[model samples]
Target: MWRRFTTVVGRVIPGAGSRCRKRGWVTPVTVVILGLSFLWTGTLADSNTPRQSVLRVLAWPGYADDDWVQAFEKRFHAKVEVTIVDSDEALWAQMHSAVPPPFDVLAANTAEIARYAQAGMLSPLDLTKIPNRRWQQPFFQRLSDIRGLVNAGHAYAIPFTWSSMGLIYDRKQFAVAPSSMRVMWDPRYRGKVLDFNSAQHNFSFAALALGYPDPFHLTPGQMRDVARELVNLRRNLLTYYTLPEEATALFVQHHAALMFGNYGTQQVEQLRKAGVDVGYVMPDEGALAWLDCWAITRNASNLDLAHQWLDYMQEPEIGKQLTQREGLANTMMPVPGGASDAGPKLVWLQLVENIGQREALWQRIESGDRLRTFPQ
Candidate 1:
């Protein structure tokens, strides 16, 4: 369950064109479809004393691999059982709905944690039993720091891997390289662009185009303005959704121009090697970042083992390995120190529950009240 880091590269600012940034507040109905909260109620972790059996976990694709599972078993004399979830939101419904939540450990992200905490569906972390706790970077010192926008700061959650959200594009698409954000909406590139279907990413992209703050603090009007811009993006778009595998295929085989790339540089390298001329740009507007961490359920079956796993993950050796192998940029993968960014704590605001304050912004986008972009 470890990933690697290649190198640090630079980022560019993107563009906004035509009537994109000039419209009404997006309505809330569409939000319903995309706004399900993550509810993790499983018993992957059970027992306070050492156990001989395996621990069950509902995590993402990478965590379920055999080699990773075997390694943990060998180290602690306990086996690991894992399940793969389609989305963070899906994991949420499964945990909260079932009584005695079947899984003990749930792979979680920053935004999802805050919602779970608010809902009272989680348990506090006990650091005393976990041996791997000492290795964590200062970033995960407290749940609030790693979870950031997600409010379950203390008593719940431990950091695992983290990264920023930004643009991934085909390299051969442009000659001189369009580094600025403005190029994304160029009339010439119409119909060649592919956008992520996520509201957070979409609105964040628009907010950046408007010279708004990074991890934008959307006001009633600012958020509305962002929704207007994305709806208009419907006209010139080739693909208006988020699919990593599909994006890869579209870029290489179908000539798509761009899509939201999570994690970081690896996405760019993957496309380039697959015979697509792909690349990524961080953008001057900065971008939404995230940490996919591990958390214990309120009624975990194996409290001791879960705590042990939490500490194990913190060890620099284990954490670094996961980051490099999984292509996840945990809390330690940043600029070596407490490096600074230009705006509001990009570190702190990475995860946002845009459901409340940004409701109007999302509504207009869903109803197409201000949209006019891409192919109609």
Candidate 2:
């Protein structure tokens, strides 16, 4: 067993959105989510051996809190080490790093899990080891129905959380909710818009605004069109933000008229807690949404422990806690009348046509490139 321990430190921001931040850490550290004290400290060189049966996890900021981690550790009689990541790019980098995969299990979106499984970095799950699947709602239990969870007669990921990226606007600014995503580019809201700084979602949102039938699978010609649209969007945006907290700060500081809320209701809860009355609208073309799942790593040192972690997360109480504490919807059961499910039409995320093309175009847009660079 790999016996390595590092300290993961973070600050206690005021609301739910505060957990999402651009992670800046010197070295890999494992945070023991005990009382879940949000402490901020610079990188510390504390080299100590972890106790036996360490189950390292890679998850989003709010996914692995103290309550769940502590309970999981107690139930499984293992030491839990969590690594918080802000973006799918971070998850990719950590898993594909030169070092052996540092995490035993990871929570990622359906698209990402597919990419990882394609790369042969994920392990086929032993369903018999995870008894909690029976307790999940039918939507989650039937992996065969979900497009990306099962591949070639093998289960690779377990459904966990799901939400969407909707158009969020200041209720005070608009007496009525903006009915279309095009409102963000209305020139009226120019310099008052905040957009997510993600290559995949940005491209898809632009396609949606352009009325493309398949936003995720844009043609090369459509790609160029989307790129041009994004450039126009860049001109309107005060700035691009990666994390929900940053978006919240920008919205309040700049008095932003609108934003593309990537975290869905979590962002709404955060903004409300921060004293902002915002309205979330699914644009006429529908909004981009995602289903995040948990998967065991191919390099997991303790495969059984990893399965136990998945089972623990599927428990109804744990799912409820996730919704209550983090404002995200879990798949353990249907979200019955909650902000998590109250949104515009959700266009579930699909595998993109070409991530490389999107990233290249996104870089140009971010660098202030002219629209003429796109294929005319």
Instruction: Tell me the TM-score of model 1.
Output: 0.72
Clashing pairs in 2: none
lDDT of 2 by residue, 33-133 (tens): 22222332556535683555878888886787876877777787787878776666667777776568888999989888888888888999999998888
Off by over 4 Å in 1: 1-54, 74-79, 86-88, 142-153, 214-216, 240-243, 315-317, 332-376
Candidates in order have lDDT scores of 0.57, 0.77
Per-residue lDDT over 1-376 for candidate 1, one digit per residue giving the tens place of the 0 to 100 score: 2231222112111222122222232111111011111222554545675646546676754544455565667787776656555344446656765787777787777667767767776778765776465555655654443433334235577767755666776666767655556667777777777665455556666777778765445765776566666766765566533334445655555477766665444455457667776666666656556666788877777788877766766667666566555565655555334523313323333445465545455544544553444223
Whole-model alpha-carbon lDDT for candidate 2:
0.77
Task: Quote the lDDT for 7 in model 2.
Answer: 53
